[model samples]
Target: MEALGWFLFAYQVFVLYYFAVLNFLYTTFTFFGLNMVARYARELSELSLKDLLEREAYLPVSILVPTYNEEKTIAASVRSFLALRYPEFEVIVVADGPKDRTLEVLKEAFALVEVDWVYRRALPTKPIRAVYRSLAHPNLLVVDKENGGKADALNAGLNFARYPLFCAVDADSLLDPEALLRASRLFLEDERVLAVGGTIRPLNGARVRGGVVEELRLPRGFLEKMQIIEYARAFFLGRAGWSAMDALLIISGAFGIFRREEALRVGGYRTDTVGEDMELVVRLHRKAREAGRDYRVLYTPDPICYTEVPSDWATLRRQRNRWHRGLWEVLLAHRAMLFNPRYGRLGFVALPYFLFFEALGPVVEVLGYALL
Candidate 1:
């Protein structure tokens, strides 16, 4: 028993040491990524707004919003999207068979009328009951589909999307009016860029008017405030670092833009995983590298999306559990790329970093606490 105790103690120490080193590396990567984003944003912003607008190169985008019992915030969210400043775009809201008045609220709010539209299955999904077009908002379409989780619902949205670029957002999230225009510009500017992810901020305490965030204020609640700091550290430091190295793995689902053909060719969103967003990104990198294609998956800081963070510990825990599980699922699904030479930086550095630090860091911390 004494020997076993010593073994456990040594194991805990080892895990703690590993955790520290991994965190240091993550911090390093984050610093680099953040600098890259800052420079990119500055350069992008320097371009005259008139020139950007008159570039004669607006790419049509389809915004896919997947909702499940989001009645409380659905109207505001949809209204926000409708007000986007893009020249051409469509919003597809997939009502994932909500038990509440979600569908009814949308129908009445948007003056939706059932429309006969043709869609082909790009990814396997639950049965879609009906598709509706809003007479009020000409570009808005809503689909009533069976509850098949967020991933499945997004796949359903992808099947019905008509644009060359598709963006997936949550029903409770609100995006900046120019977010899409800023993020999608990279795809147009660089033919090799495959996808672009934007920075996400917490929207808990922001003042809202006409479904747009009128002001940015720190939340009064401790939890919300902590998330605000967390988001700042994440986007300003973490994602920026990863983007610098071109090893960005997960783009926030709240606001990410992808080439429609590339997304479809890579099998769209995976239905079996809760971390479909991250999984799809990893697959994009894997496929691109495998095909010997020169491509870039980028993260930009200018396009901002604000999402509601859970205010309570219970809901927060549930969200974290789902996210951690999803990370594990994605890692397991692509275990083949772990240190595989062909994937270059992704295989050697990025994948291993996620496997060690992001995925296993919690377990290491827990064991350290147990030992103490």
Candidate 2:
């Protein structure tokens, strides 16, 4: 009994140490994130943005939206993309064989007509059924493809993307007018930046008209309203900190831009995992570091993409489960990088953080509760 008591006391000390280290790291990140965000905001002012446009330095971008059973939100989302302030961009909506009326609604809303599009398949994806061109918006193209997951749909879109840069977005989300311009500017300013992640806000309470969010408001549901706060904290602090350090491992799947050639060189999104976004980003970091190439993956708060949050408990639970599982999968897949000097900060610091604090957070929480 005495030995067991000593063991318990030691375990308690370890837990306390773990908790302190985690909070200290979070605090440091928060400070770094705030500074980075402030700098980004100043650089993204109206004059700077206008000058960027006038200089014609921005690269053309292809927006790849993967749709699945999204009949209600598909049209509005596409319209929002159409109204972005970027100089040159094409909206490619890949309908991932939805069981709902997603295809029909897109066709009717955009006056889509089947077109003969011939392009090289740079990446292997599920078979595509047909391609459509919209009469209403010349820049919009819709591809009806076989039933594939989000990553697969993105792969299909990647196969036909013509631009040098590609932005991946969810079909149910709405982007701010300047979202693309803000996100794409990083790539233009620095040749080393391979990818940039943008901020995503909850769209549950926003008023939408003509594909634009007219007003930003708190969501009606308690859960969704809480999520808004959670998202703000994560993006404003967590991602910003990582970006400032140039060790950001994950760019969100909801909205992020990537250099086309770099993404293709890394084999696009991995279709096998739920955490494809993080996996792709990690692979990018690994590949770049392994090649001895000077490169950066960034995150900025200026680009805002609003997406609807799951209000009900069941849906939210499933979402959280998927996220946790994905985090574990990514960490396991890249376990070789942990504590390795070769990957620098990514291996020595970031990977370990995700492995312990994030991947095993739930277990720690459970243990703490049980101890109490």
Best by TM-score: 2
What would the per-residue lDDT of candidate 1 be over residues 1-372, giving only the tens digit for each residue?
899899997896787789688778867977797678668757776354447778767799999999999888899999999999888999999999999999999998999999888988877889989999999999999999999989889989999999999999999999999998889888888999999999999998889998999998888889999988888888877787888888989898888999999998999888889899999999999999999999998988889999999899999999999999999999999999999999999999899988888888788778768766
- Clashes per candidate (backbone, < 3 Å): 4, 0
Judging by lDDT against the true structure, name the best candidate: 2
Candidate 1 deviant stretches above 4 angstroms: 1-16
- Across residues 311-359, which tens digit of lDDT does each residue of candidate 2 receive? 9999999999999888988888889999989999999889999988988
- Using all chains and alpha carbons, the TM-scores for the candidates as numbered come to 0.95, 0.98
Give me candidate 2's TM-score against the actual structure. 0.98
Question: What value of lDDT does candidate 1 attain over all alpha carbons?
Answer: 0.90
Question: Stretches of candidate 2 above 4 Å error?
Answer: 1-3
Q: Residue 160's C-alpha lDDT in candidate 2? A: 87
